[model samples]
Target: MDIAILSVSLNVHSTKRIVEEGQKAGHYVELIDHTKCSVKLGEGKPQIYLGEENVTDEFDAIIPRIGAKVTKHGAAIVKQFEMNNVFSTARSLGIMRARNKIRTLQIMARKGIPIPETLFSINPHNIGEQIELLGGPPVIIKLQEGTHGSGVILAESKKSAKSIIDTFYKMDTSILLQKYIEEANGEDIRIIVVGNKVVASMKRISDLDDFRSNVHRGAETEAIKPTAKEQFIALNATKYLGLGVAGVDIMRSKKGPVLIEVNASPGLQGIEGATGVNVAQQIIQFVEKNGHRSRK
Candidate 1:
């Protein structure tokens, strides 16, 4: 089997692991950097070129390793692959939807999936009332399209929340403010959902004085199987979001486990290391299964 991966940093740990796993499974892998790739739609045909080479070549399947920031170009590259009737670990639309937190949450809520009381208002004038609607001070402000906990801001005071939200709006940044779960203690569970099951779960704990618990934000992780309810939420959230592979963030609160966000391209380092699970193998298995069907 020959596989191609579209990613920004080919040397990243996750991309490296996927390549290694595919090779271990006796598959040839090519890690293509989408940022450096060019696309052309003319001359009665469409083609994607990677550094002067027409990559319209055939392959067993594709594994998209897109980051939240490079979603546009990455999905476009994956879309070209799909047009050639190639299977992907995740669909382009799923990758785009998972990149945007606000849209994903709206879809989840509509699907009857339980999430934290969330508020998203584009009108900066409604910031005060939106905060009140979501409960009060201490709300989680998240940029609509950011990853790795880089765009999350926890506002504790009403005045501070309003000011920060206004600034974000002034800058034309899309964001959502939700009821902050104090009982969560700046910790959350990352449930890796592959296909239809939760492959592994990890408890992401924040560093001292930090509100975000992402490993990128100096968080620690440990292997822990989530409860039956947590597992249900994890699975349903993925299904609701139409994600093939994802990292579903769940916040444990007094009410119950409420979903925070669904990550389409979840990192493998922390989750795989914490659980001691060969997640890349599972992903390859899933891809091969689908590839088999496509071949049929």
Candidate 2:
């Protein structure tokens, strides 16, 4: 099978590993930089171009490693492939929904998946009330599209929370406020789901000085076997989001496990290293099963 890894660069660790694994599996794989791709729509079927080359029918499947900054354009390219009847690890709509925190949470909440009490409002006048709605003080304020814990903030007091939220609203930045799980102790679970199976999971402990438990934020990671309920939540979250591959983040709270986020194009470096799983190969095999089946 021929595969295309839709990413901005092949130099990225995940992208390189995927290409390596696909080769090791005896499949032809190439990196297609979605950022440099263009789409052409005419009287005939739409065509996707990489520079001057037409790529409409060049591959059997696509593994989109779309980044946060280029999600819209990247998802568009993926959507074009979907229209061409090409199999993709992630659906276009799934990428769009997963890119936004509020959208993902809304879908999760509606699907009866457990999640923290999250609220989003654009009204500057009701900033105080919005914070109070979450029961106030020590709330988790997060950017709607932030990745790797860059825009997540922990406000320890009502005064600070109000100020930070008001400032965000005034600047017209999209954010969400959630009830902070104080018992979490700066730790969270990262579960990697390939197809319908939970391939790997790990517990991420945040730095002593930081509350965000992202590996990119200097968090330490160790392998973990998720409980049956946690495993169920991770798998269902991937299914509801329409993602064949995902990294589902959950925080262990007094109310059991609450999903904090779901990543459409989950990075393989942290989870792979922590769990000692060949996640890249699992992705390749998933493609092998579904990619050929889609051709039927």
Candidate 3:
């Protein structure tokens, strides 16, 4: 099978792992920097170009490892491939949907999937009322498209919450407020799903001074088995998002496990190291099964 890993660089850890694993499985794999890709339309069929090379039907499938910074352009490249009857592990729409926290939560809420109490409003006139809507302070403020725990903030008091939210609103930044789960104790779960199966899961514990449990935030990790409910949520969340591969982040609140977010291009390093699972190989195998079929 021929496969293309749509990413910014081949040096990235996740991209390298996928490449190694794909080669080990005897599949022809190549890395295409989606940021450098361009699409030309209105000249008969759409043409996808990688610099000087035209790449319309170059592969049987694509595994998009799209970065947050270039999500819009990356998704467009994937969309072009999808239009040309090439199978992709993630749909372009799913990438866009998972790029924003508010969008993901909205879809989950509508699908009967459990998520934390989240609120988003562009109105700065009622900042206090918005905070009150989530039962007052000690809330979580997050940039809609933030990654690696960089744009997450914890406001421990009503005054601080109001000030922070107001500042973001005034700056014209997109953000969301969520009820913080103190009982979580700086810990969260990341479940990796591929092709309707839960391949690996890990518990991330934050540094003493931080509340975010992202591995990029210097958090410690350990492999763990997800609860039946957690697994159910992970699989269904991936399905609802229309992604064949994803990482579902869940937090335990007073009301059981509530989803925090779903990652369309989940990293393989932390989860593989924590669980000792060959996640990259799993992704390749998933493509083999579906990429062989006619494109839908």
TM-score for each candidate, following the candidate numbering? 0.95, 0.98, 0.98
Residue-wise C-alpha lDDT for candidate 3, range 17-103, written one tens digit per residue: 999999999988999999999999996999999998998878899999999999999999999999999999999999999998899
Q: Could you tell me which 10 consecutive residues in candidate 3 have the lowest summed lDDT? A: 287-296
Question: What lDDT score is found at residue 125 in candidate 2?
Answer: 84
| lDDT, candidate 2, at 86 | 95
Off by over 4 Å in 2: 293-296
Provide the lDDT at 17 for model 3. Answer: 98
lDDT of each: 0.87, 0.94, 0.94
- Give one digit per residue, the lDDT tens place, for model 1 in 1-296: 77887777767999889889999999888888888888899895688888898877647688888876678988898888888788888888888888889888888889877889988888977788899998899888988887898888889999999999999999998888889899999899999999998899999999988989999878999999899989998898787766788999999999999888888888899988899999989999888877733332
Report backbone clashes per prediction.
0, 0, 0
Clashing pairs in 3: none
How are the candidates ranked when ordered by lDDT, highest leading? 3, 2, 1
> Model 2 over residues 159-190: C-alpha lDDT tens digits?
89989988998898999999999999999999
